[model samples]
Target: MSSEKIIQKIGQLYHQKLLMLVKDVSLVLVVVVAIVESVVRLLVVVVVVVVVVVVVVVVVVVVVVVVYSSSSKVVVVVVVVVVVVVVVVVVVVVVVI
Candidate 1:
């Protein structure tokens, strides 16, 4: 009977240790899941910022091209007008003199 009690006590101790191991494993799993979630969120934010910056750069490039082309056209028109006015003034002065 004394040996029987010793065996039962040993069995109980083994069961307690198993429960503790399971609890530790579960805690470690929860921490790992949290870390993974944080990493995913950070990656998502980075992707969004990159996309926004790319779009802004494209828009600015397009606007600059359009504005520069239109400004070039205006410069050409002004040059032609100035040449015509100068020719007219020279002819008028020759006739008057």
Candidate 2:
């Protein structure tokens, strides 16, 4: 083969190699982008779940506090009624004697 023919073949081979390299680089970039997007989506879901749990816990706490306060008020009213009844009975017995 002549030198001119050999040079032309070498140039063609280099061009093909360059094209293959560009395709490989593009594939790598696409895979990296997909992985990053998936991680970000997962993080967002976790944050949303945490926020919902916190809100539910706060609502439950408020309800419990209100119930406890109402029960305490009922106990106080019962105690006052019992004391008044005892005092009235003692006064009636003294008046009869």
Candidate 3:
């Protein structure tokens, strides 16, 4: 073959190789993008679950605190009533005797 034809053949082969490289690179990029998207979605789901758990725990704590405080108030009221009755009884007994 002539030198010009040999050079043209080399040029054609180089072009084909470049196209193949571009195709492979684009495929790799697509795969990487898909993997990243999946990881982001998974992270979103995990965050949602964690938030729900935290909210449930907070609500339970608040309920326990309210019940404990109310019961303690009831106990205080009972003690006060008993002390007043004892005082009134002692006063009457001392006056009569």
Candidate 4:
């Protein structure tokens, strides 16, 4: 074969290989991005859930203390009710979303 033709063939092969490598790398990057996105979404959900639980508990405690600070029995009943309501709300929220 002529040297010019052989050189052209080698150039074509190199171009094809380069294209294949780019496609492979792009596929890997897409998968990695999808996984990272999923993890970030989950972390965001967890943080939101934690914040919500903390806020609810704090509010309930404050309300209970302010309203029934002198009655131990009433305080206990209110606390138990608050706990059950919090649990139910959390479960419903989680399930709905």
Clashing residue pairs in candidate 3 are: none
Worst 10 residues of 4 by lDDT: 88-97
Ranking of models by TM-score: 3, 4, 1, 2
lDDT of each residue in 37-73, candidate 3, tens digit only? 9997787667656655655565565556656776877
**Could you give me the TM-score of model 2 versus the true structure?**
0.58
Per-residue lDDT over 5-84 for candidate 1, one digit per residue giving the tens place of the 0 to 100 score: 99999999999999999999999999999999999778766765665565556556555665677687765665565556
- Indicate the residue-level lDDT of 40 in model 2: 78
Backbone clash pairs in model 2 (N, Cα, C under 3 Å; residues 3+ apart or in different chains), count? 0
* Candidate 1: segments with Cα more than 4 A from true spot: 69-97
Which 10 consecutive positions of candidate 1 have the poorest summed lDDT? 88-97
Off by over 4 Å in 3: 70-97
Best by lDDT: 4
Instruction: Note the Cα lDDT for every prediction shown.
Output: 0.71, 0.70, 0.71, 0.81
Model 1 residue 86 CA deviation (Å) reads 50
Q: Report, for all candidates in order, the number of backbone clashes.
A: 0, 0, 0, 0
For model 4, residues 32-86, the per-residue Cα lDDT tens digits are 9999999978986886687588767767776968585787887777778777777
The reply for model 2, stretches above 4 Å from the true place, is: 69-97
